[model samples]
Target: MTVRMTSARKAILEELESSKAHLTINQIHERLSGRLPSLNVSTVYRSLDFLSQNGLISISDMGVGTPVYEIMKEETHHHLVCSSCKQVIELENDLVAPFFEQIEKEKKTKVITNHLVVFGICLECKEY
Candidate 1:
């Protein structure tokens, strides 16, 4: 599905691509407001939805109250979120591949999503 790349979409994609942290719609809008004075939250929302649907970006809850968006990369990765501290730890695909494979085999279905967020208490929180 090919969609026209509007200025809003391009700016949104660039913002996500440049950011290491997953951004919410408000964050993205706030960050881009300096450069894109005319950009609105609704446009950001729409662009994010379009980007997510087109596989350019990924939206994950990451144990946060609201969803966060990040640009998709060639090397897929997951997240282990600390439920207490809300610290996000990047989980490598190596650890997840076999688990996904097992699910695929057991369910006889394909696992299409490249990223997953597992919420748990971190070591610090557990020790405390």
Candidate 2:
């Protein structure tokens, strides 16, 4: 599906692309507010939803109360978020592919979501 790029969507996409860290809706709005005076939280939310639906961006919980958004990359990966320290560790797709394949075989359904977030205590947190 060809998504019509509006000014708001374009700005939001660019912001996500430029940011190395995941951003919440409010963060996206605040960062763009200076450049786009009319940009609102609602618009940012809608644009994020639209982009995510189109597979252009990914939304993950990352153990945070609010979901975070990042621009989709060619190399898909998941996250293991440390509940204690809030450290995020990247999990490669290869490690998850077999698990997803097993689920697909058993459920007879296609897994569409490429990105996943698992919450747990990291080694450091667990040790301490």
Candidate 3:
């Protein structure tokens, strides 16, 4: 499917894609408002929803108050989330093959998402 960007929506997307910082919708709108002062909150939200649904971006719950969005790529990785720091570490999905096979057999259902997130305190927090 071809993705066309309207001028304003494109501006919002460009802000999201260009940000090195993982930003919430508020952050996105904050950046865009300086450039496009007329940018509305709902437009930003709708654009994000559209981009996410079309596989143009990956929306991850980084354990922040709000979720963050990143440009979509083929890298299928999981997150090691730290409860103490809210840090999201991306790791390769090199494991879990056996569990997938077993689940599929027992449930007889097609596996949709193999993306698993392991959440706990990191070593630094344990030391404290």
In candidate 2, stretches whose alpha carbon ends up further than 4 angstroms from where it belongs are none
Arranged by lDDT with the best first, the candidates are 2, 1, 3
> Model 2 clash tally?
0
Lowest lDDT sum, 10 consecutive residues, model 1, at 56-65
Each candidate's TM vs. the true structure?
A: 0.90, 0.95, 0.77
Q: Report lDDT (Cα) of residue 20, candidate 2.
A: 63
Best by TM-score: 2
Candidate 2 achieves a global lDDT of 0.90
Predicted structure 1, TM vs. truth: 0.90
Residue 117 alpha-carbon offset, candidate 1, angstroms: 0.5
lDDT of 1 by residue, 1-128 (tens): 77789999999998888886799989999999999999989999998999888888889988778889999899889999999999989999999999999999999999877678999999999999
Error of 2 at 9 (Å): 0.6
State the lDDT of candidate 2 residue by residue for 1-80, as single tens digits.
78899999999999988986799889999999999998889989999999999999999887779999999999989888
Local distance difference test scores for all models: 0.90, 0.90, 0.74
